[model samples]
Target: MDKAEILVIGSGPAGLKAALSAAEQGAEVTLVERDPFLGGQLVKQTHMFFGSKEQYAAERGFKIAEKLSREVEAHPGIRVLCDTTALGYYDDGVVSLEVKGRFATVKPQSLIMATGAQENTLMFPNCDLPGVYGAGAVQTLMNVHGIIPGKRVAMVGAGNIGVIVSYQLLQAGVEVPAIVEALPHIGAYHVHASKVRRMGVPIYTSHTVLSAHGKDSLEKITMVAIDQDRQPVAGTEQELDVDVLCIAVGLTPLTEILFQAGCKMVYIPELGGHVAMRSDTLETSVPNIFVCGDVGGIEEASAAMVEGSIAGLTAARNFGYGKDSYEDQLAAARRELDSLRSGPVGEKIRSGLKRLSSFGEVTQ
Candidate 1:
C-alpha cells in the first residue's frame, strides 16, 4: 500500500500542475500517468500555446512539457508515476492501480481527478478498419513516434483538432486530400483553417463521411455534402482513393470513474458531452474527490492547468497543508482561469459551468 497527502490522476496539463501546486503548498503529492510518458496530450502538441506569459504562452507544447518535467523533478514533495493506470476506485478513499504491471493501492486524504478526455469517434461502413484512426492517435504516431499514419489521408471533421492535425499531416509529409466538416461554415478558428488552406488542402464544409471501402484494411473513402438540416444531399457524393481516414470530430470527458466514485454527473454538450459536477474550487459531489481539466469541461490545456492549480490549493487547505493563505492562492487561481475563459472561445464554457457552480455554499 502507498499513501499521500494528495493524489492526482492523469498527468496531463491539469494533473501536472495540480500535483505541483499541492506539493508547493506543503503536501505530499502523488502524480500518476497512465502512459509510459508524462505530459499527456502535451506530448503530441507541437503548436505554440497562446495566453499570457504566466500560462507559458508562446511556448510549444512539447517544450512546455519538458519545462514542467524539470519543475516536477525539482520539487521533492511530488512523487511521479508513469506507465501507471488507476484500475478502480472505492468509497474508502482507496484507488487501485497497476504501476508498470505491479499492482498497488493508494489511500489519499484528498483526490484530484484530471483524468482528461477521450477522442470523439464517428461511425460509417468500415469505420473499424485498420486505417481508420483518431486525429490524436495520428498525431501521436507522427509527432511522438516519428511514424506517419499514412501516405494519403481523408480527414473527417473540420474542428480545431481536424484543422491542426491536417497541418501536422502536411508537416509530416502526408497528403491530406481534403477535410470534411458537417457544418456549413468551418468549425475551427480561421487561423487554423488558413494554415491548412495555405497548404492547398481543400476544406469541404457541410460535408461528412459517407462510407469507407476496403477489403482487409482501408482502401478508399467516400464523402457527401449535407443540407442545413445535416441530412445528406443525394447528388453530392465524392470519393477518394485514400488509405487512411482520420477522424477529429471532438472530445468527450472520461466520466466513468466519477460515476463509480459517486460524483454527480450531468450532460452538457457545450462542456463536451457529460461532465462531473464541480464547484468553483473543482470539488465534486463526492467527498474529497475533486475534478479539474477536461474531466470537468473540455477546455484548452492552458485553462486545464489553471483549474488544476485551484484544485491543488483547495486540496491543500482541506488537509490543513496551506490554510494560512489558501483563500488568497485560490482567489488568484480563479481570477486567472476566468481571464482565460473570457474570449469568444470560452463563451460556451461560461454557460456550461453555471450549471454546477455553488462554491460559496460550503467550505472544505
Candidate 2:
C-alpha cells in the first residue's frame, strides 16, 4: 500500500495550515482539494480579516490564502493534489479519492479533515427559484467569477456572511435593497452593520422572508415582521422588487466523512450544525484521525487556521517529529483559538464546543 505520514482534505485555511505545519514539523504530507484552484473559501473572500498579527490581521482573505498556498507549494515535504475529492475514509486512515480524474486510495499514518462548510438554506415559497442563490454562491459569482448576481438584491439574514456579501455587492456596483433579519438585533458585528448601514442598506430586525416570487426565476420577494415567538405577524407583509434573493441564514459543517468513519458527532445550532468532537490538539475520537476548521465547528478562517496548526503539530508530535516544540506550539494554538472564541459573540461557540468535549477520555 502506498503511504504517507499525513493526508489532509479540503485545502482551506485549516487544511493548508495543517498540511504545511505537518510537513514543516517532519511528516510527508499530502494536501488534497476538490477545486481546480487552491485556497478554499479564502479565494472568494475579498475583504480584510479581523484578528491579531499572527493570524494575518488586517490582510485580505485572498492574500492570506495566496501566501499560505505558496508556502504549501514550495515545501518539499508536502504534495499538493488539486482537482481531488476524498470519497471515503476507512480504518487505519485509508482514504479513497478521485484524483485528477482517476480513482485512487491513500494510506496515511494520520489524517486531518478540514473540509470546511456549506451555506444553509431557509424554507419558503418558491425557494427553489432559479435566481435565488446561496450566499456563498452569490459571493463566488461576484467575487470569483466577476459577475453580479443581479441588478437589485435582497440579503436574507444579517449574519456575518449576509452582511459581508451585501458589502461586496455594493463594491461590485450592485444594488442591495436591504438586509433582513428575524432577530431583534442584527446578528453580525457592529462594524459590518455600520458599514452596510452607512451605504444605505436598511437592516430590518424582526423581519422574515416568507416567499420569493416569479416563475422559473426570482423577480421579487415577500417578507413580514415576526413576533417574539418568531412567527410572522398578521398584515405586516411587504414585497420588494429585487432581482435576486440571497439567502445567508447560516452554514453547516462538512463532517459527513467523519460521521461515516465513526466519529462522535454533536449538533450545535450556534456552531452551525453537526460537528465532530475533538481534543485540544484537534484529534477526533478516532485514533490518528483529526478534524479542524469548519468541519469541527463553523468558526471564522482565523480560528480555522489556528486549529489546523494544532492538529498538524499534534499529529507530528505523535509521529515523533519536533517532540520538544510540538506541545508548546499546540498550547499556543489552543490559547489563540480560546481567545478568539471569547467575549459576547463567541459565547455560543465556546459553550457548544465545551458540550461536545464534556465527556472525557474517549477512544475508538
Candidate 3:
C-alpha cells in the first residue's frame, strides 16, 4: 500500500488547489485523476471566468487549468496519478484504486474528496438519439478535441452551461438554431445571454423540448412553450431542423465514494443533488475524510477552489503542518468563499446551504 499524508481525488480545480495547499504546508500529498490528464471540466471550458483576481478572473478557463496543472506537475511534495480510478473506501481506512487497470491501495492519514460533478440529462422521446449530448460532452468535442458537434444545434436549458456552449458552438462555426428553457427567464449571466442573442441565437423562455425525431440518428427536435406550471401550451409546438440537441439542464455531485465511506448525505437541489454533509472546515462526518467542490455541493469553480484550499489547510493543520499561519490562511479562504457567494447570483446556493445546515452537525 502506498502511504500519503493527504490524498486528493479528482484533480479538478478543487483537487489541484487542495494538493497544492497541503503540499505547501509540508504535507506528503497524492493527487489522483481518473482521466489521462488533470484539470477535470476546466480543461474543456474555453470561456473566460468571472470572479475576483484571486480566482483567476478574466482568464480563460482552459488557461487557468493549464496554469494549475503545470503547478501541480512541478510540485515536489505532491505525487500525481493520472489514469487512476479510486475504486472504494473500506472500513480499514484504505482507498482501493485501479491504476491503469492494475489494483492498488493507498492508506492516507487524510483523504480529500473533490470528485466534482456529472452532467444531468433531460428526458424526452428519442432523447437517446445519437446526436444528443450533454453540454460537457459537446464542450469536450469542440474545445478539447477540435471537433464540431453538428452544423446546427438546438440547445435545451438556458443555464450557464447551455448558453456558454451555444456561444462556443458559434465560435466553432456551428449554427445554434435556438436555446430553450422551461424556466421563465434565462439562468445564465446577463452578459452570456446577451452575447448569444447578439450572435442571432434566439432564447425561448418558458419552453421545453417535447420530443426528438430521427430514424437512425437525430435529425430534428420538437419544442413547445410551457406554462408556469410547466405544462405545454396548446398549439405552441415547433420543430427545429438541427442535427444536434445539447442538454445542459444542470449537474449533480459525484458522491459515490462518499456513500461508500458512509458519510452523512443530504439532498439540496440548488447544490445539484445529494451531497455529503460537511463542517465549515470541509471535513465530512467520517473524521479525517473531507469533501470539497461539487461532492459537497455544486458551485462555481472559484468557490470550489477556495473550499479546496480550506479543506487542505484544515487537513494539514490536523497533522501539525502550517501551524504558524494556518489560522490566517483558513480565514482568508473562508472570506473568499463568502465573497463569492455573497451576491444575488449566489442566492440559490445560499438557500441550498441553509437547508443543509438545518440538518445540524454531523458528529464524527
Expressed as tens digits, the lDDT of each residue in 194-223 for candidate 1 is 999988999999999989999999999889
Give the alpha carbon lDDT tens digit for every residue of 1-364 in model 2. Answer: 5687898998999999999888998888989999998899999999888876889989999999999999999999999999999999876667899999999998988889999998888899999998888999998898889999999999998989899999999988999998999999888988998999999999999999999899778998999999999999999999999889999988899887998889988777777888877776778888888998988888889999998898888888888998988768877887888778779878878887777777565566
Alpha-carbon lDDT of model 1:
0.87
Higher-lDDT candidate of 1 and 3: 3
How much does candidate 2 score in TM-score?
A: 0.97
Candidate 1 lowest-lDDT run of ten: 355-364
User: Between candidates 1 and 2, which one is better according to TM-score?
Assistant: 2
lDDT of each: 0.87, 0.89, 0.92
Q: Give the 10-residue window scoring lowest on summed lDDT in candidate 3.
A: 292-301
Clashes of each: 0, 0, 0
Candidate 3 C-alpha lDDT tens digits along 253-349? 9999999999999888888889988888989899999998888888899998998899988899999999999999998888888899998989999
Pairing residues by index, what is the TM-score of model 1? 0.96
Scored by TM-score, the top model is 3
In model 1, pairs of residues that clash are none
- lDDT at 77, model 1: 94
Using lDDT, give the best candidate's number.
3
